[model samples]
Target: MIRDATAFLNRSLAVISGIEVSGLALVFGVLAIFFVLLWLRASGRARLAQRALQTAEADAARLDTVLKVQAEMSGRMQTMAEIIGSRQADLTRALSDRLDGLTTRVGQSILSTTRETKASLSVLAERLAVIDRAQGEIRSLTGEVVKLKDVLANKQTRGAFGEARMQAIIADALPSSVYAFQATLSNGRRPDCLIRMPNGAPGLVVDAKFPLESFTALQQAADGETQAAAATRLRRDMDVHIKAIAEKYLIPGETQDTAFLFVPSETVFAALHEDFDDVVQKAYRLGVVIVSPSLLNLSIQVVQAVLKDARLRASAGRIQAEVRLFGEDLERLDARVTALKGHFAQASRDVDQISVSSDKLQRRGERIAGIEIGEEAGPSEGLKSVAGE
Candidate 1:
């Protein structure tokens, strides 16, 4: 039994050992499988890490290149900004200078315009004042013209007006002494005025009576028949007046051969010249000069000039007499001046001889005083020396 037990024990021990060995082997195999799986995972993880590291390295390189490009762009941007700022500064300065110039020119132009406007306003004001004065004068003149027209409406007033106008013209043109108003002639006819001639002969006679009614009718006629009748009446009236004046004023030795038929109205005179050539010729034949106020004034002025010429001639004769007297007086003055010069020359010679005598007397007196009480001064030698001097 002991032996069998021991062998069984030994067999159990061997089986147990085999089981343990198997378990150990199984553990080792599992460990080895786990190790292998871990190794495989690790290797995969390592490969993923390597791939991630390589992608990270490439991204970092790309980031570095982008950062460098960004830095260069920032520098270029700063430089561009500085250039724009400099250009803006230059543009601002130039615009400011141009605005200053324009402002100065505009100010000067405004000042000049202001001065010109002031001057124009002052001139306009002066012209307005002058116009106001002219307007006032025109008003006064219009009133006077109305009054004059009223006065000229009647025949008597018209005749008086003509006479007064003739008198005024005569008074203005001739001196009071050279003209007479309403003087009775040698034929017992009263002439309106008479102008004294320069030769002291008979004066020129002027008659102021005119046929104004027929002239007025002629002027008022509108129709041809009325105008013709009025013109015929005017010619007849003028012929009668011319005959009357020729018979009344024209005297052989007392008055001029031609008598003036004074027409105060210039219109009437113009109408006579224009339409009544036959009447004018008749008046000329009758020695009646149809004179308007203007013509009469001219005649009076001519008379004045003739008188002035005569007076100048008379004055020239008187001046010649005075000049002859003045020449005689000048001759007398020259003779007196020559005589006075001769007297002055004689007085100078006498003064020179007296000075020489005084010198000779003074020398002789000194010689006598020096001769110690018995002086024998030679008067003949002193007198000879004075004569020689």
Candidate 2:
């Protein structure tokens, strides 16, 4: 626009030179208006450039501040990473230690449980062994009981059993010289045993044969009527046994006034006493005593004591004679000791007299030595003077 305005001004000057002075003022006025327009446009462009420089400087300052903030944030993040790593290492070490402690405790618990289980098994085994031994003992006892039942079932074996038991007791209690088994008496009858009495007394008899059939029936009877009948028979049997023993064994000059009826079983003896008082009284009245094994043992002990006392009394006269001889010898020894004391006293007096004579002789010798050889008396004269004094 400026160049088009300048071209238009040049054309106007040429046109004016040809026309006259009246159009010169109008050309000058148009040139002056064009210069004013050019100055205004230039001033506006200068102001725009100054505003752009100020905006560029503000943007650079903001970018520098952002870079400084990013550097400080990076340093803080590195320090936090180092702290997290150290904490993780510590936590791992603590977890390992806890695992080791738990393992040790579990091992110890397992060992203790194993030892307790073994001890319980050992005790159970010992108890089973003891039970087996008890079973064996029960079996052996059952066999023995069966054998005893067989022995008691027969009549002859039962009577022999009683006789054998009585003989064993007598042999154990008395000496061989004082008793005899199955000895014959003067009446042509043999009793089971005979015991010799001391001091020339008659012998005593013991009879072991008893009426067991009636007693056995009494034991087996179940009803009242049967029991009564069995009891009557038992009493009658006891009376016959008592009379027979008295008549056969009690001879006036050969045996004692009383005899013993030996009952082998203590159970039978106890039953007889409990249920048959009349039978026991009748036997006692007829000079017969009913005795159990224990009672017979006690009677034998008494007899042994009596025999020992009699033997001791028989040796008393010899003991008295020996005591008298000892007294006579003691008197003779005393008399001899008195005579020896008198002899010792006489010997002492004779020794005293001999000492006095020796002293006188010594004094006479001393006197004779005092007399000098020049003017002393003779030794014979000195000796005569000493003897006279």
Candidate 3:
């Protein structure tokens, strides 16, 4: 390629006009301008072509080197990928085994927790059953008690029940001396009950029987006429009972002018007033007061007031007795004190006489036992005994 380029240059120099050759050097002195222009243009193009050819050859060599390098790297990359995949498989197996064991343990824990919950539920159920049984027994016992109380409220036994209960209430409310029970009125009929008055005198009397069965039957009657009949019978019975008691027990200025006929049941009192208005009006005219237990309780309060005054009087009597006894004791004490003072004065006079006799005897003894009477002179020498004998 260099030889071909040199031969072309020789031919180009030979064909030029007015050109001279100095050995291998060609000179176009006058045509130097054209030559310079042509050389500039052709040299630049020829240099560019040479550079392009060199660059193409370098590029081809570089491509061959790149292909060989890529082949070697591909083999290395494949071997490394196989090794990494085996390690990953080992790690995955280890993780899977660990997860399986953990899952098994978790399942066992869940089962145990479930079993405990079931056992607790069973115990709760048993406790609930026990509570249910206890509630049932309590309800049954309550029912029986209610039935017993209802039976006592019936007319057959209500009178006795009320009397016993009322007596208990009275006993609890007052002292024994403040009241008395079952006192005989002056009319020779013993009143059903009595209370000591303010002066310890007889108090108002009460009769405690009033039938409720007929009234209850009246209440249970299907028709108004039957109810009216029941009412008539109850009212008539009450009037008869009151009249009998009044005839037997009510005496002028003896039994309390107003007497109480206690209706143990309010139902009977209500029946007389509600259905048999005329009979009640008659009872009022007869001066017989119809009283239920509640009304009688109010009447008893009146008796209690009288009893309070009686208690005060009794207490006054006790005070009077204490004062009398105190006066008697003071009189006896006064006599005893007078005797003590007299005895004390007599004892003092006897003591004065004994003192004088002792002084005389001491002087006589001193004269009989005489010695020199010096600074310690004996008293007998200093005294003149009887006649100086």
* Most accurate candidate by lDDT: 1
* Model 1 lDDT tens row, 313-344: 98998999999999999999999999999999
Give the clashing residue pairs of candidate 2, or none. Answer: none
Model 2 spans with C-alpha error above 4 angstroms: 1-148, 322-389
Model 3 CA lDDT for position 370 = 60
Candidates in order: C-alpha RMSD to true structure? 25.7, 32.2, 32.7
Candidate 2 local lDDT, 224-343, one digit each (tens): 999999999999999999999999999998898999999888989999999998899999999999999999888888888988887778877877888888888888888888888888
lDDT for 164 in candidate 1 is 92
Stretches of candidate 3 above 4 Å error? Answer: 1-155, 178-188, 266-271, 313-389
Candidate 2 global lDDT: 0.82
lDDT of each: 0.86, 0.82, 0.72
The TM-scores, one per candidate, come to 0.52, 0.48, 0.41
TM-score of 3: 0.41
Ordered from best to worst TM-score, the candidate numbers read 1, 2, 3
